[model samples]
Target chain A: MSENNNYTFVIKPKRTLWEIDLKEIWRYRDLLFLLVKRDFISVYKQTILGPVWFFIQPLLITITFTIIFGQVAKISTGGAPEILFYLTGITFWNYFSSCLTSTSNTFVSNASVFGKVYFPRLIVPLSVIISNLMKLGIQLLLLLMVWVYYIINSDAVHPQIELLLMPFYLLVFALMGLGFGLIFSALTTKYRDLTFLIAFGVQLLMYASAVIFPASVVPADKQWILFLNPLVSLMEAIKYSFLGQGIFSWFYLAYSTIFTAIILVIGVLVFNKVEKGFIDTV
Target chain B: MGNIVIKAENISKQYRLGTIGTKTLANDFKRWLYTMQGKEDPFLKIGDTNDRSQKGSSEYVWALKDINFDIEQGEVIGIIGKNGAGKSTLLKILSRVTAPTTGQITVNGRMASLLEVGTGFHPELSGRENVFLNGAIMGMTKTEIRKKFDEIVDFSGVERYIDTPVKRYSSGMYVRLAFAVAAHLEPEILIVDEVLAVGDAEFQKKCLGKMKDVSGQGRTVLFVSHNMGAIQSLCSRSIYLKHGTIQQTGETDKIINYYLSHELKTEDELNLKVNKDIPACVTQVRLLNGEDQKTKAYLSGETLRFAFNIDCQAQGNYQLGIGIASALDVNIFSEVSELMELNNGTFEIDYQNIQVKLAPGNYALTFNLLYNGKSIQYCEKVINFEVLEINRMGETYSLSKGAGFLITQGKFTIN
Candidate 1:
């Protein structure tokens, strides 16, 4: 009990937009882990299938996507098989959408705890990102199994050397989702109308980012439209590296990087500004 | 007391009264634009006092108004206030749960608040897991929790239920487990609200003893409760708050007595308001003397009179009841009109000369309307009257509080 050290904290009504103390966040890292643990464990605990439900969601979605877009609409998958193509896209898209939605609603759902106790409010959104990563890991394993089966059975698809960039690509993607989430969640505290819009907005964003269709399928004249969407390049890059079936360009990737970096800065700034006063509004 | 651990200077918090959010984004964007232009928040200038009873002219109100105080290390300071007095808001700002709208607070050491017991406890989680989770939420690391896990379990006395899910535990066990986790956290300052009110009398005493031990170790504590006796016994100093501002701060006993005697007042009649669902209600309750007229104060040894009016839409048997409470909101005695032979649709009744051997202080009256033993409406502390000091027992004010709240007759025989 006597071992703890002193901390000199001056609490005020207002602070700079970037007055984040990374050291305090570091101190509360254990809380972050426990919260992430709670998120993942609680979601699946009561269900009989438990974590197996994680694999089933994307798998079913992929099957439906393949039937509608692949067989019925006959959308070109850039010469790769339809199932593998849709699975990879859904895997990454699932991480981003789930991360963004959870982060955006952080203030609303955790209002009860926020009202009663004080913690680094950012920990909630950060843990949501981390927890969704666990589901992504499980989904990635499912994708790897399907990828492995195709590799042994056929020579139509080959893996690219850039496949090694999978983890880095996912991190950047997660950060962008987190950034957008922080902005929306903070804003939603005062104006709750955004909560309804986000659910619809994320779905609309999936179509714009080429989640089910490849950038190559869009004609060259219309290609600028795909490039304008920052996430299209990320989606193309991930698929190009994994299945060797999507468009590739460093210029667009750099453009996506800048787009993500800007949103993240805005996200952190907005999050910091909102945390102090959101309790009253919420 | 040692060096000062917490210093709050000119603290104030403004809150929007009815609605927090702007109805549309345009109104919101204009406000944000005004903020970015370095202009004063035009909206903040518009609001009334945060009194909920009266509908104010504007949407904004100041919940806390220029609160200033300094707390010394090892001092257990009691914060006493009526409801809507801003005690909770002040504690919230001190614990950093919410920032004040103005002013600054400097804290010299790490602080933890038990604003609510079992705050983040998950129903599905085991008691042990909840302890760890709750400890981590307080900023204690895994190693710190490990060092005190056994002791916390022992103190909670829930070792038998440690492995079981908290949802299965009795409400008593749940509160004990939650409090044990908070009590074990070794922050330099601890802030507690009325969390002990949930516990039974024995547990409340144990909580007070533990708080005493915490203060004994030189930890600053800010305790808030409506219980005057608890505040007097536990705190070194006391602060009285009314309408979002401090009314007084001084020695615990003096402040407690001042707070009780000052808030308590003389009254003879109470007009109770009815809520939506209650069909039967007590609209008027009056205290009287033996002459069947309204009287303000009662002599210490006098038998009190109660006259009340019960308005019921239906003519079924209705029970009009009166409850007597101390200044601290402790219920002392209660009686129903049904027992007093007031039956049926008779809207008004008078009952006289009930034995009330009470000490000299203000006591609150609560009126109730019950139909067939079911309570339809209850108004607590609607009106209070003073019992003038006659020095019947020949004891000082301090001695009277220690002996008991009431002055009853008892025959003593020495063997």
Candidate 2:
């Protein structure tokens, strides 16, 4: 027996501070796909229009912003068509907000399952983000149609080669949403007050991110404050990349990326530690 | 054994009793501050286990305290306890659904737990989709589940409804499919907790057979159940818990004996008061025992003796009798007097209890009072007793093995 123990010593079973076996997660990928598909179908399962609600939401929001801000207040769209400009901001912001809200509530919504099983908890939040991304893709297609219509009819619209960087902007927004969502998810497991705060906080964050107005409207003195909001850099970067009209500095985008990375690291650390003991408290 | 699959040392879980809210937070913080200054947590020293059941004592109960045990591969261990006895709490801790307040549990293999069947199954998802989802939740990989998909559907007997959403399936079908998926996953360690109680008798028997098969595959199992029969039949070793403490841990029969004898205490007498008068009263009751002071659990097809004392008031030739009943109040047999018996006085009766060849189960003895051979008072469930099967002679002599609690002497030949 001693010899057998010594022979098995080569396995070196030692507990690490943070040991997340990603391969085990990969093995359950089929379940992850099924969950995402279930989320997509269940959202519109009993609805009259089915997937049409996805397009209607963004279109209605764009029209509301056009009448309230564009026609009445003359909120500048920074030389881009009002419909294209508003739809772009609303479509991307909706994806981020939905992903953030859903991911933040993952633990509370799945506590029944979590209390009874021992699966990797990361799969739930990851599937939520993926499902929201599909919704974002459909909304982006509608925005692109508006962009093409303006390009053909209006000479003031100048589509720039920088528009090819749209995917990079999407990645940044997704990372920001996931990072903040994970932090809230971990905290909400203990103090459920965070759930109520997040519902209102997501709406308040849109005002600070320049989603309703052009980034150029922020005065030179107040531009530093806009830079403090990570989503502001993300929104302005996407606007400048596509419409060629807002501030597009690599320094600001780099700062946003670094901020997102740091928060993502901290979010993972907190989430890992919280998952170990949250069932007892939750 | 070369394979020591699980090793737990001094694992104790201490939960703060009472409402877990801001007040507990304040106390926890105060305790933390004192600990930093070299003082113990003051509240931990102020309570004992006996004070736990009283109202307004903060309901501060320890669910499990100072639990330590280990198991080798292929060993099946039963956790037996009453409600609020920490059986589920210990399983939850071992299954990683919750963490202990102190100590460590070292496990050498992947563990899967069916703490409750259909835990992660989405109600809107079809049975086919739920198979994968619930399997994943129980720590089975897609490839592993895919390989067993057909077998799971066949075993559940829900093949026709596989494409239908589980919310629409009958509850029996839902549980069967859920248990099927959990059983087929085949992890190194299986933890089951009271889920078998939900299924039908046939399904429960099927589940027990599957559990036996899983253990036969050289894996470890941790089973928690309140059913002493199931525990004794399935587990070689068993642990008995009482008030969050380990009362006994050893061979299954020994632990079960301790549980059945020590833990099954019932109230001796009933105290009821009407507005104007005391309608009836219990004169005397005592548990009969052998010379060893141990309650006689069984008799060898002969009469057993019980000693009783009774006092009567305002009696008009009262008839006295004793009835033997099962725990659930189904009377097995009774002896009553048809002649004049008693008056306003005290008396004692000693008789060898007659045998009706009772089965091995929990039973109760009730005494009845009658006036002029007509029943006047009935004492319900007066004293609780247990009948155990004699095990030393032969396997066929076991009362529980379809012997119908009677010894017969008829010979039969095979066709």
Candidate 3:
């Protein structure tokens, strides 16, 4: 008899519609954490400034948006100061975009590791979300410091009771990004056409999400177009909650939540189906 | 037999041929539509056999077809075959890295696979960091890796540069570290695939020794290798795979003999062509027994001779070389005929009975033609032959790693 505990593992073709075994994921949680740590550590290992890129990237992008949209284009912030307005948008936008791009590349980028070893395939994308969550936390603090500075120095910005809703907004953001990322990645594994389309499509998606201009400036009839996007309502609500400006409604938030939940469910189902066979096609 | 630790029931894998199989969405939709109607997958019904040469008539092929076997606890089994024989595919399915098209496998214990050494070693990570990373990727926990960290470092013999980035290490050093980490994974079942072929001869011998020690410790091992000597020496039983199906499986000597004799008998040598970049090609290779009779196999007591028929585009000073490689693809010995000896181009340059000291198991002959101090034509594993098992120097075992790669005349005493 062997010294270790006896365990039997069965491997067969995945026949079920739902192949996402939560128990397997739990068993591989340590690998998931290591993958997340690797992604976080290796990102800046060779750079002279290291993780300072995390701060500099969003800061410079926010400055460009401020100059291009607020100063030149005459877009309104709806009473919130321009710096805090764009800064808040950049924080959430950066997180959502990074999540989407990384998730979409899950099978393609990790095919080497995935092809060689046996771990829960979900560990990869979950790590993407977890590692990005750490980056988001640091970026969130940076945004808060700017928000506090504006509040202490000027009357152009103010915090409202709705600011308490920020955590819910973050959850919704994570779910939507994670869900859609899973969907795009699963599809593109079989057909490479989506890879290029996603790279271009994700950029265009930002324009529609109102990352630069305030949602209140839109014409009433066109507001429906923005609402149809699952991320738009959540982004506007996140800003309105903190800035006390723009329209904020629990109904729209709830609608976005339902939309994200449905997408996430579809994402999981598609991801499960494709992962088992995607190795061959890819 | 003891308890069955691994059982594969009716395992098979079907692959579609050509780019159209993977690149088209239309066919996938068609297949999906057929499946939704509760019918057999329409594409799976038709295909050619898994042959790489010549164009086939169908687009779908079964890579591994209905393979069934059971391994008892603590049994070390070897799987061997030529290229495209489904050996790697079978190992992949058993390791759970991929799923079979239709089959089930039950494994009764923790299993770890070393499909390739250093599979997840990041170039930027130091050797120490990669040890933890690669171990974790292979399903080892932090505590488990920590417990064996120093042993792994010691085994690799790279402790002096454990903190240096692995990218900076020489290839031999990298292989040392990678193999060291993988070897230390103390799973109940170990699956290895041709990984021991990486390091030098001494290291390979060391790895084989380590693997034998592991099996002795009561862990079941499934090994896939082309090295018949290693297989004959290490495995208690063996499986011979041909074109994605089990051709034979039984005692180690029986299966290895069957595989070698099978390969030597059926391999059509007219198709083997040397490098086209050169003006010469090796037309045929043959081995004659001591009685001057052509043979594909011989007993260890018989004299071995290599006779080659070569062709040249233009008659000139051509030096012909013959290289002998173990079944594992290691070039152990090579000899070349002098240009002065091959003046008559078409009827010359053959080596005969220099010394036949090779131990038992399969070996292959590779040829190189040097037109003037430069190798213009070369071919690897062009013609292979087996040295069947026979008593060596009064010893019962003739084929074994410890028995050595070649046989030498020695005095034996029986008092």
State which candidate, 1 or 2, has the greater DockQ: 1
lDDT of each residue in B209-315, candidate 1, tens digit only: 88889889988899999887678778999999887888899998778778777766667877766544666667778888767778877767777788878766655
Off by over 4 Å in 2: A1-19, B24-61, B266-353, B357-383, B387-415
User: Local error of candidate 2 at B310, Å?
Assistant: 18
Model 3: per-residue Cα lDDT over B1-415, one tens digit each = 6888888999989887777444477887898999999999887786466766657787778889889999999999999988899998898888777789998988889899888878788888889889988898888888898999999999999999999989899999999999898889998899988766667889888788889999999999999998877887889999999988899999987887677667654232324454455656566666777777777666765666766676666556778888888765567788888773343344533477546677776778788878867887677777777766655565443244444577777899999
* lDDT (CA) per prediction: 0.84, 0.75, 0.81
Per-residue alpha-carbon lDDT of candidate 1 for residues A21-65, written as tens digits (9 for 90 to 100): 888898899999988888887787669999999999999999999
Q: How does candidate 1 score on lDDT? A: 0.84
- Residue pairs of candidate 3 with colliding backbone atoms: B357-B407
Per-residue lDDT for B315-414 in model 2, tens only?
A: 5666668877754335677787656556656666554555466666566777776666566567776667666666756532322445233444569999
Clashing pairs in 2: B17-B60, B304-B353
- Best first by DockQ, ranked: 3, 1, 2
A-chain TM-score per prediction? 0.97, 0.92, 0.95
Relative to the unseen true structure, what is the C-alpha lDDT of residue A261 in candidate 3, on a scale of 0 to 100? Answer: 95
